[model samples]
Target: MESQAAFNYQQQVEEIRLAMGCDFVALALVQSEERHFQIRWEFASGNLSQRFRRIVLHSGKGVAGIVFKTGKPIFVPDAHQYYKKEDMYNYPILIAEELESFAAIPLFKYNRVKGILLAGCRKQKCMSIEKFELLQSLVTPTFGPYYSEEVTGI
Candidate 1:
């Protein structure tokens, strides 16, 4: 049986993909203690392939990993410009999904980076700054079993 939280993550990704008209939307979650907090691609929608399942991300490595380690969002208007063709291979999701533009946000829980959310497109710069901001806002403040501890307006 699928866990409710896992189910919610899938549903949320699908909803975000449709609402944003994105080519791909995925969630990377950190595994619990027995798993050593390893980050893995857990849920996704609009993906071109299942290659993400074969990938295991480390902190500060791929898009999700970087966001996970830094606790800051990463917005790449043009993946090609932002990352060299060779460097592109470093991000499994980008290569697997053939993403040309993308944005990754860190999901916080108890003030620590706990998960990652990514939205992207196959076309260059398709994920615009405005759209990126909107994406950030859409997932803001809360997610299942996780709540952003970001400091907001006074």
Candidate 2:
């Protein structure tokens, strides 16, 4: 798969954020072998922190990590209710982005999970099921080199 240009990535994420009425939209990509396959938040829209650029995600460690590990999307209509206050700390993106509702989908290339697309809002129930479904649908046959037809989170 061809790598996405930074400008294109930014534009796409920004479009998604606006279309979906999300407070934040981000893409996390797996690093090359030289970087030891770490996952880092690469492109973002509506973000409040620069921490994502420096944080590397491990499999099963966080929202992006869970999606990367499971190859399925995780949608939480209410992050505050779904995750305990203390346990929510484990999900760095939620805290870092101040997300209250969110979902994540795995981006696959060659049958391997290569990236993650996450959308979120800082308000409760802001990421409705319909919206989440729309996001998933929008991703199909598009989203850089990834196709939703060939992959789904859950």
Candidate 3:
């Protein structure tokens, strides 16, 4: 059952990457409580290598971490401009993927961020505001088992 779910997620990630015309797309999911809710890049499409699997992040650490911690979406038109060369190590995913531009959104569950969805390109300024906005609209109310936005009571 778990494998099936992962397969479905992989397909969805690939579809999103294709739809967004990105060079790479990935999903970072929160591990179970046993792992202290650590986040890991579980699925990816159009990746340059398998380095992303080795990355495990705590909230507020990397790109996934920051988005997970803040529960807010982020768009970087130029990774180099947004992050200094000396500070590139802070965003391992971007470095691993060699992404020049990217955007990521928090995936919610039970009003809490449980995952992250990221889309990126290798060319500088390729991820424009319009592209980021389109990615936002694609997620809408939900993305797989997680909600794209936090759910609140009236």
Top candidate when judged by lDDT against the true structure: 3
lDDT of 2: 0.84
User: For residues 47-102, could you state the per-residue lDDT of candidate 3 as single tens digits?
Assistant: 99999999999989999999998999999998888899999998999899999999
- Model 3 spans with C-alpha error above 4 angstroms: 1-7, 140-142
lDDT of 1 by residue, 1-154 (tens): 3244453678888888898888999989977768867889989999887888888988788988798878889999898888888877788889899899998888876677888889999999899988887777778533665654455564
lDDT score, candidate 1, position 81: 87
Candidate 2 or 1, higher TM-score = 2
Instruction: Looking at model 3, report the run of 10 residues with the lowest lDDT sum.
Output: 1-10
- Candidate 2 regions off by >4 Å? 1-7, 149-154
Clashes of each: 0, 4, 0
Error of 3 at 89 (Å): 0.6
TM-scores, one per candidate: 0.87, 0.89, 0.91
Model 1 residue pairs with clashes = none
- lDDT at residue 111 of model 3 (Cα atoms): 85
lDDT of 1 at 129: 88
Worst 10 residues of 1 by lDDT: 141-150
